[model samples]
Target: MGERKLLSPEIVQVTVDKVNIIQAKLKAVQDRQKSYGDVRRKDLKFEELSRVHDVFHISMLRKYISDPSHVLETPEIELRDDLSYEEQPVQILGREEKRLRNKIIALVKVLRRNQIVEEATWEREDQMRSQYPYLFQN
Candidate 1:
């Protein structure tokens, strides 16, 4: 029979180092996912606020444009000429809304990509855990 083999100290140390490196990489990926989620949330909130602002501005402009005499009586319509500038606000809001929407779409795409990567990693981890429960068990 062949002699029994034993792991040398250097080999054991290398194995431990590899495991630690894998664990650190996994943690970094998880942290990155969390950061992306937080950024997405903030973008959503900003989009919502921008939508509200746009709607309010549109409503006010509509009121002034549709009934100039009545709105002027309220003293809020101080300058009739400013109505010409209303279109600019609408255009600006439209551009901002579009930008925010695009950002949201981009963020969602990134999140989906991250999820796919994480899912694959999780599956591999699960398989490893099942195959080597003793090694993974705390």
Candidate 2:
């Protein structure tokens, strides 16, 4: 069989250019993935808050049902009575949950924006890959 000839210089140049463009696109995708990771982490914080809120709500409901009058008049006093004197920790945690919930909402908005950016990036990447299937075909 005849020996295979090397790629022409023009073909080599074109391949290099294509590779550079793909590399740039890949970097952009990676940056977007990182942004998504950040947003996902923030989402977890909200999920955690949701869990705490659910528990607190249940406990508050139980207290109200058990002692409606106390709960109605001087809820603050009843709340304090319901918790131990070392309740400072619980109060701090509640505050943290609220803060996390607010932050998580903000992050969700950012995530939605990133989703649009990511979709555009993926569309471009898919277009390039389709145009030069050999470049990305595994």
Candidate 3:
């Protein structure tokens, strides 16, 4: 004999909480974009690039992404209140970009679990070989 399980109120509440959390994250990203558009940076083209440039400083990003211990070894950043408002967006972008990268990794794992490889692959190796940052750089 099999028993039927019923949904508890706590489980329903947890689902609702998760949705709310996701909505808040989306709103935060939208807010960052709006503020970004409002700012004027001569070096940056707002229309061409949005938050994607957040991690353009690859060296700093790699330190955080690949070597967490190194980042932890640095002096505490929170105690320094000397940071400017302009610096906030850059930090936000780096964090969001890292989150996006992590999500991509997670997605790849899910795809593998489903017995599916990449959605699209390079048809030719020669064609796929392209220039590095130079190709996409300003």
Off by over 4 Å in 3: 1-4, 41-138
Superposed on all Cα atoms, model 3 deviates from the true structure by an RMSD in Å of: 32.2
* Whole-model lDDT, model 2: 0.45
Candidate 2 per-residue lDDT over residues 1-138, each given as its tens digit: 999999999999999999999999999999999999888774333333444433455455543356555644432332346674321110000111114534532111111121333332212333444544553434
Clashes of each: 0, 0, 0
For each candidate, give its TM-score against the true structure: 0.28, 0.28, 0.26
- Model 1: per-residue Cα lDDT over 1-138, one tens digit each: 999989999999999999999999999999999999888774434333444333455455543356555643332333366553221110000111114534521111111121333332212334434544553334
* lDDT for residue 1 in candidate 3, whole number 0-100: 81
Candidate 1 yields a Cα-based lDDT of: 0.45
Q: Please give, for residues 31-99, the per-residue lDDT of candidate 3 as tens digits.
A: 999889778545744565545543455565544357556654453334346763221111000111114
**Which regions in candidate 1 have their CA more than 4 angstroms from the true location?**
1-3, 42-138
lDDT of each: 0.45, 0.45, 0.43
Q: In model 3, state the lDDT of residue 38.
A: 70
Score residue 14 of candidate 1 by CA lDDT. Answer: 100
